[model samples]
Target chain A: MAVEVQYYVLLSMALFSIGLFGILTRRNALLFLMSVELMLNAANINLIAFAFYHGNLTGQVFALFTMALAAAEVAIGLGILLVLYRNFRDVDVTVPTTMRW
Target chain B: MIYEQIAFALFAFITLASALGVVLLREPWHSALMLGVALLSIAVHFVMQAAEFVAMMQVLVYVGGGLILITFAVMLTEREDATDDTETNADEVVQT
Candidate 1:
């Protein structure tokens, strides 16, 4: 019972869509970062699946790098979040006093 | 082989459900906890895909490091007296 790559693709797509929905609907900056993480994991799943399909370690290695980058992204994102809160007195993205659309 | 399929089905369900929880939950702390579940299950998925080392790193880096940072942000950013925490303008979701 070998699993098809398509199953993984579909799963990844569903996960990515959920992330997108979160990003679109949620105003919490932390949730926004978490949704970005979900989207990144979706991409990671694809890399690992295709690596398994091709019988190589490249995808796994790249996934590791992606995780490292994700960790760094979270670190910086949290820094910005703290600053946003400090200045705005709220976490709502729409209530910022410094930046406006 | 059959067991692998079963396991994939089970964990994939966990992954998606918790991911939804991460988004739809009322509390950001709850969402952060849900994010932990989603991250760990994703590690299990890496194991299923035969990337054992990646699975380990996923747990170590994502669950251990990344999730901790997110939780800290939630704790640090949220105010104790502020109770009006709500999403802003659901109307903007459909707009360009």
Candidate 2:
């Protein structure tokens, strides 16, 4: 039997939900960055699945762009995390309360 | 057809489990390892779906580049004493 597109969609949804849960519940800055990566992968999965199902390359192209963006995001995010660690000696999300107003 | 189904099931199971591990593991290094597993599984899924270019790109970009970045971040930011305290604090918050 051929694998239907819906199965891929379901898998993507499951991954996205797990990532969302991690982002919402995790307090560590690194975990938060990891969750965002998970979410990006979920999106990439959906994009490539649909691209294959539709017999086109647009989704694949977009997925490549998404990967580039994700790389840049991780770079900037980690840079910020490094600075945050240097400043506060911790990467806890709750520790950066200087601008809490 | 059956083989394809089996492959999909296997890859999906691995990807999901490792993704969960990424979020659930207490140690950041372990989580990073799980993330690598999840990314590889996703690359396999891409190959199964007949997106060879995307699959290779996934391996290159995420497994090669992203994993290295995460490792560097983990190494650069890690402090033994502070990590223990942070782990305890995070665990307590998670438990509640």
Candidate 3:
């Protein structure tokens, strides 16, 4: 049995939608970060699926770059979460409007 | 035709359910756990699509690295029930 491109695309769409809903509804900062990760991975899956179907390595290479970007994202995201937690004492992202200067 | 479609549908269902759990669960620890499951399922999906290397990296980086960092961050952060001091700071700025 072979997998179809439409199957992967539909799965990616479903994952992306779930991520969007999470980001929209979750007030917690950590959950928001997870949602962002979900969205990024969904895009990566799309790229890889395209790469496989087209027999081109470019899409897989792009997925590698996407994963690298995700690593950078987690670094800066956790750093910000740390600062937000230190000052706010909670990771709720819905509550900040001031800059520390 | 039917068996393959059924298997794919089941996998998709599992992936979506776990991903939903990751966000909907209130406990960050639980969310992290669900995220691990979701990542693993997505990796299986990747393998099913014949993207073997991507699938392996999905498990290695996402479940191994990303979820671990998320759990550590959650643990290090303040508890969910605490009143946010940052709110007070914002209030002070508005008053001044």
Candidate 4:
């Protein structure tokens, strides 16, 4: 009746892969940010799942820190995204070619 | 016991599907909504795993704050005419 930890691990892996694929294929900067968040969520899921499996609170505590970090990341990332849109007039990831060598 | 398995399957399916929708949707607003759904489902999963505090935090931070931030970004960055033109172009590519 109890859910196996493997199932949770597999679920997180699938989510992480989807996020990675989006990062690689999506041209929209906002989509990239969303993908990154998805990846982070996957990591958090793993942390908590392992914590539960091991009967310890370390993983959950780490997950809490991860959430705080995610919050800060969203704040900084959105600010950068807003600036990028203003400067380039588009949120397309391919627009910023100036840095390309 | 059986019910727990069923709930787990349901939550996992919803979470994965909406996560896919988040990345694959053309409209940013739609993607944002899907992301919200995915996060909510993950919160449900957290509850299933007995991490009640994490589940609440997931709802508060992700569903509440993160979603609003994404929605605002989508609104602020939207240029209606430009988006329409781009949408048509994307449709053409998809058709081909």
- iRMS of every model, one decimal? 3.9, 3.0, 3.4, 3.6
Q: Write the per-residue lDDT of candidate 1 for residues A13-48, one digit (tens) a residue.
A: 999999999999888888999999999999999999
**TM-score of each model, paired residue for residue:** 0.92, 0.93, 0.86, 0.92
Worst 10 residues of 3 chain A by lDDT: A92-101
Q: Compare candidates 1 and 3 on lDDT and give the better one.
A: 1
Q: What is the lDDT of candidate 3?
A: 0.82
Off by over 4 Å in 3: A99-101, B1-3, B80-96
What is candidate 4's lDDT per residue for A23-57, written digit by digit as tens?
A: 98787778888898899999999999999999999
Instruction: Give Cα distance to truth, residue B49, candidate 3, Å.
Output: 2.1
Ranking by DockQ: 1, 2, 4, 3
lDDT of 3 by residue, A26-46 (tens): 777888889988888789879
**Candidate 1 — number of clashing residue pairs?**
0
Give the C-alpha lDDT of model 1: 0.89
User: In Å, what is the interface RMSD of model 1?
Assistant: 3.9
Q: In model 1, what is the error at residue A22, expressed in angstroms?
A: 0.4
DockQ-based class of model 4: acceptable
lDDT of 2: 0.87
Error of 4 at A19 (Å): 0.5
